[model samples]
Target: MSAVGLTYLTLILIAYGVSSCSSKEKTQRSLKIAGLSLWRLLPLLAAVFGLVGLFQVFLPPELIEKTLGESSGVASLLLGGGMGAVAIGPPAAAFPLAGTLLSAGAWPPAIAAFIVSWVSVGVVTLPFEAGVFGMRYALVRNGIAFGAALLIGLLMGLVL
Candidate 1:
């Protein structure tokens, strides 16, 4: 296992131990909830991976480099951020796609923007968000996320 995986496992075990000691019933309930959530997520995970595989197979590396390469600069970041904002699926799914893009010669800053906006701004969920929170609030929040995504990409470009 990777160091990060081992660390996560150790932390999880420690938390489970403490929780079980404090209240076995509650620990069991928590575990059941987690299992159910994982079960529900399995189909989505499978679909996302399948799509990613297809993307890798069909999308040319040269095309990716041409559109999102380091030379594309600010335009690449903007394009990546826009695509991410409209992307559907969990943040977990985006990570693999971002990794694929990175390995295929997409600019690091573009990938960074993609990840940031994919996790933060959700155009697909905007209506629901607006319904729960006021439309104005949702718009403002998304706007902020979009701007922050671009800013983060810019900083990443400078640093990396």
Candidate 2:
């Protein structure tokens, strides 16, 4: 298990122990808080997991390797960036996709860029983002994220 999973398990154990030893009111309060937290996080978790499955079904590793893995210098970089823009999903979703791409022989730098841009910059969620955060904020944030992803990819190519 991951460190995060282990930590969550440890916390649950501690919470159970404490609830058992506490007064009824305190135990009830703790349970309510925990329930509320889980309720709040459920939608976000579901969205990420759903996106992950959808990506797995739609864009296979072979396609990623074929397009972005080409060695055409600037054209390849643009292709990588474009691919990232097209694939809209969460970071959790992108990790598995990145693994698949790597296994299919995609360059590490391209995969890194694609994953980072996929999450950090979201063309698909633009309307929702603009509605909540304002168009200017959404546009600027995405623009910066896109540029940063490209720069990061180039640096990774150079360093690694």
Candidate 3:
């Protein structure tokens, strides 16, 4: 780990140790909850990182730069937003991928749109959302999310 990361880990460990000493039962309960949450999220975490590895290998940086570069303009926004909406997994995956895109010459607006839409929009989860919240609600929410993402991308491009 980096020095900063090691320092943070040390601090967290010290704090956790102190907390456990102060209240054993509470600490145990908290640990149990944390463990359960970790277990629940492990599969998703694995899948996302695995996908990221594949993405890094399969998608040429040249393609990303060409399609999502600053000069790509509105097309970049649309493509990024559309890709974000369709792509599944988590914000964890999006952030790293966005960084990669940015380093490869993608504009800030496109990257921002991608991250926002990836977190908020969910075309892949539509069926589940509809099953729980109704089809119309899901569709409307996704549509609004998409529209707002584009607008945010436009404004960001102008401001930044």
Question: Compared with the true structure, what per-residue lDDT tens digits does model 2 show for residues 1-160?
Answer: 8999999999997878877786778877887998997787678768766755676678776666666674555666666676787776446566766776666667777777787788778888888899999999989998999888888988998898
Instruction: Name the lDDT value of residue 104 in candidate 3.
Output: 71
On lDDT, who's better, 1 or 2?
1
The whole-model lDDT of each prediction reads 0.92, 0.76, 0.85
TM-score per candidate, chains pooled? 0.89, 0.60, 0.77
Candidate 1 residues 1-160, lDDT tens each? 7999999999998999999999999999999998998898899889888878987999999999989998888888999999999997778889888888899899998999999999899999999999999899999999999999999998998898
Q: Kindly list the per-residue Cα lDDT of model 3 for residues 17-106, writing each as its tens digit.
A: 999999999888988998998888788878777766776788887788789987888899889999899988658667777877787778
lDDT of 1 at 24: 100
Regions more than 4 Å wrong, model 1: 1-3
Name the candidate, 1 or 2, with the larger TM-score value: 1
Instruction: Candidate 2: count the clashes.
Output: 0
